[model samples]
Target: MSKLAVGLMSGTSLDGIDAALVSIDEDKKMTLIDFETLPIDHEMKAKLKDAMDIGASSNELLCSLNFELGYLFSQAVKLVCEKSHTKLSQLDFIASHGQTIFHIPDGKFKSTMQLGEPAVIAYETGVPVVSNFRSMDMAAGGQGAPLVPYFDYVNYLSDETICLLNIGGISNVTIIPKNASIDDLVAFDTGPGNMIINGLMEAFYDLPYDKDGQIAALGQVNLELLEELLSDEYIHRSPPKSTGREKYGGFFVEDLIKKSKLPKEDLIATLTKFTALAIVCNIKAFGVSKIIANGGGVYNKTLMKYISESFDGQVEIGEYPDAKEAMAFALLGYETLHKRTSNVPSATGARKHVIQGSITYPS
Candidate 1:
């Protein structure tokens, strides 16, 4: 049987919501039917940014944004279905990755929180929704991150060591060794992706992103700053690790600006190179055969050029590059519905595989 489902993702970039509708067959093959990205408005983006700050917002505001984001996600689903000419009644289920506000992969608590309310989506769309996909893996003694490795395993398994590099707000790579099974995979975040670059753009250029990295292309990279950034401890960390806004957020950007004496454009150019270098350094250490890049960062020409130049092997863009994460969530939902475990225990550091999300039925 073929099941039609929609996946919604709000990544660490805080840029927008990506919704993708895909058809999955009994054999677990996915065909993306349609997709859309609903950019976050300036006000909402600011609100989300504020919420991400520690001690910046109250519990009440955080509580309200949870449902507010849920409502916004419902609107995204409705608009995507309208544009795709698909009705809610025709869908099997909706899978939402929600908006991640905080992720603490290591600590005494070791918890992660993603805020959009799944019940609101279920109620508004009149469809079953599967969400909060990370907690189960965390409970099973895992990092509860880089969940898309399972998706990569299913779709990109091959006879060569291939790295699926996703550069969203935070960059993570999934390494699939030759003739790799799920247990043979290794994955982890490779420090800041567009997080720092986008932060610099908003602060100095007053833009959302560097846009094809045009700003970076206009300036020279400050080699001194590049070397300084490369020395960050996160870049040297081994696998089975993850990081987010807590490490590379606004405060980090402010600190970087204070430490650098270079011009704005030069600083951005350096940061763009930093992103590329961080990814390349990790890939080389892992001895990856080829790199298949995806996510919003792939669109930044300068960043892509830096990555391609630094990497000696083949570098290619993923199919449906922008919609990869959204589609992954949809595939997770499909797997959950079938009572299948969707998490890669090796990638997430889980003791065992388990169904990853909580299902919410329509009222």
Candidate 2:
């Protein structure tokens, strides 16, 4: 019998929650039974973005969001269950990529926080929940950011060389060779995906996102600004490196804006193009035969079209058209439930392949 698993993901965009109900067999084959993205309203989005770098003045505010987001996550899970016509008790576990507040990969503050409390999800859903997937990797001297490679390998295990690129708030690529060995895999953040693009929309346009990338497509890409963005050392950095809104944040965009001195629309267009270029550069660096794009960024038509042009058929746009990250997390949750190691030591630079995440049983 196939096991039913729920995977909940809140991306770097803080746009909303993506919940997927996946049925998996012993051999790791997956069938997506149900999937949905519940958009967080303007208030939640504002609160989350504000809390990213700035220190919060109120403990009550932070604590409230912690529980509220948990409820929000549970509701998302409930909605997916209803749509799939599956009950909570029938499911095995929930794998949650919790909301990330801060990701400090280096120094004394070496922990990344994803804070939709798993205990709260367990209490609300009455299902054993597995979450906090990143910290363990960080403890083991890994980036603790790109957790999708395990799932990427499981679904797209191939004989030829391939790269799985996930474009969320940050863009990360995972490399797989002809004969898959754990050590052969390479993955890292290419650069900004939807983070800069969406940040601009919210800052100037007062919108949450660029809706199919229409706003960006209408404007012209400023080559000067694009070149300036590409000049960052992060773009040229070698593999096993990961970045987030921490580096490519509002401040970074403001610098681009100052240098460009152009209309807001033109600035957005430039940043969008910059995102596409960073992705293409990474794909070329990997030298893989096929590049498979996935995540929220794939929904942006303009981004996809530019990516298609940038690669010029050298790399295909998307391997999975819909919610590959969420689907992959579902597979990760399945692996975690079965007591298997779901992390790639090479990808995260972890010393060993230890099982990630802590399980919260319904009590």
lDDT (10s digit) by residue, model 1, range 121-217: 9999999999999999999989899899989999999888999999999999999998988899999999999999999999897899999999999
Give the winner by lDDT.
1
Give per-residue lDDT, candidate 2, residue 287: 59
TM-score of each: 0.99, 0.94
Each prediction's whole-model lDDT (CA): 0.93, 0.81
Residues 1-363 of candidate 2 have per-residue lDDT tens digits of 688888899988788799988888988888888888888988887777667756542566667778788988999999999987899998888989889877887676577877787888999889999888887788788778688888877777788888888888898888888778767788888999899898788778878778898998888898876787799999998877888877888777676656667888788888888898898888686557777888888888888788878874455556454567777777877777778887887877778787788889989
Give Cα distance to truth, residue 67, candidate 2, Å: 1.5
Tell me, what's the RMSD of every candidate?
0.8, 1.8
- Global CA lDDT computed for model 2: 0.81
| Model 1: lowest-lDDT 10 consecutive positions | 281-290
